[model samples]
Target: MNLETIQANARSSLGDALKSISVQGVAEHSGKAYGIVALMYHRLALCEMLADVRVDRFQVLLCKSALVRIHLMRLAASGKAAHPLTTCASQNFSFVDAITAGQLDLAVELARLTSDRHEPRSEYEDDFLLHRFMQKRLLHLHAGEDHDFQSLMDRWERIVEGEHAPYFDVCRALLQRDGEGFHDALLAVIEERGRLFRQKDVYPEDARRTDGALFMNGLALLRLAELNGMPTQREYPNIPHFARLPVSKLPLPLDSWMRPEEGLPV
Candidate 1:
């Protein structure tokens, strides 16, 4: 199949997955419903990173993945009040807090229990292929100029006959241009993706565990960029600068600082 064909298949698979997840059921089982959301979020982040290379439009892929995640999470949250699968009213389940607290291991376990017993075979296969394609693209981006861009594209084509490695090695080579700038671009891309996630309401407000993970992971990547001196600003534009110039160099007393006329000619 060609790149378009593969993307179409992936999109169709995600659509089907959304259709299978009932909103009422999802709301009732919010705790368990979030596993898929977390996974899809991770996939979207990957797509955004790979999108910088651009053989095809990674934005489209990211959108499709995000759509599926939102639908599933909404469906789960909608079912919360009506479903009686588990009625422990006294117990509080905060999905967002759990994730932020680094409870993914538990989240996964719950997700397994809540996931559809009869998995859609085609969707499963499609998900696997999507992940594999993303991983391959990532490897290519990381490979840089050791292999010529054309040669890398050719190799990628051989690995997946129908697909292309978006921009080949262009982005990889550019990373060397100004590491900080590249890192900043990456952060900007991630922030853009995060906005999309919020707009779609893909995750339950109470279950923002995935959001925390994304932030933490992004931080780690920025740190790596810094360690390599890849370019701190490029790597972490979302992170504020600790060395920002203060409004004034003078260490004025708090009372003086607060008084509008204290340091100004009245």
Candidate 2:
């Protein structure tokens, strides 16, 4: 709960994670690294909030974002698809992590890089479609044309229902150019995520450890809105002011994020 405790745990977690990557090797253990790196970011992110009431290592988060991309690409290679477009769900925050932390240019590239590694399929699994839509809508706002975004949303509107529908609504509201609707839908998904976190239903248990107070998902979407010139609330309930603001410029000589090929140093 305390920042001090979270910081200590983060150190322990990072140390343990490095050993795991060193022993298991990055090629075989990327999924594990992805999960662990996610935890590290949350812990560090939480420490920033709890310690100084602001985030400090968001650049590190940007770095972790790249690592997550690498991990997911590797994970996809092992899946049934010929490419790495695996099923993404409420639990999948790597895209959110990437989108929120990096600038639009950098963040969009993360999605592009992941998708490029995979060949196109005649039909994407429903779950794959859902996850891709989540990333695509944001990409559409900045990079794609309005017509393309609408077509994409129309495709998702049919299949997405039940518990996951609200997530789509968040994007839907944005597409409709409804700011209040966007805020309302965004809060809904953020609250739902909080509930899931409280129930310990989140994967990798550590994902929830620090984020119990800070909701990065909400911030990511808000940042997406900001990037697209959409009006955003100055503040949301669970999402703090600092976490929502821009982090820092991408660290150049981008090797800082472990670069996947280089392997984790012990």
User: What local distance difference test score does each model get?
Assistant: 0.33, 0.59
Q: Candidate 1's residue-wise lDDT over 1-266, tens digit each?
A: 23344334434543443343445344324433333333343333333333233312222222222233333334555564323222111111222112222333222222222332223432333223222222232233332213233443354445555543222222332335455455545655566556655664766532232342244334433433333345445223333332111111233232231121233222
Candidate 2 lDDT over 1-266, as tens digits, reads: 45677677776776676566567755224355555655565466556565566444554554465455545555564572322223233334566766666555655655554442112352344445545655666667767734366666666677664546667788777667678889889888888877887785564454565666667667777876776678987888777666665645554444344432232222
**Candidate 1 overall Cα lDDT vs. reference?**
0.33
Model 2, which residues run further than 4 Å from truth? 1-3, 23-31, 67-92, 115-130, 144-147, 162-164, 200-206, 259-266
TM-score of 2: 0.71
Off by over 4 Å in 1: 1-177, 207-214, 234-266
Query: When superposed on Cα atoms, how far off is each prediction in RMSD?
Result: 18.3, 5.6
Which 10 successive residues of model 1 have the least lDDT summed?
Answer: 87-96
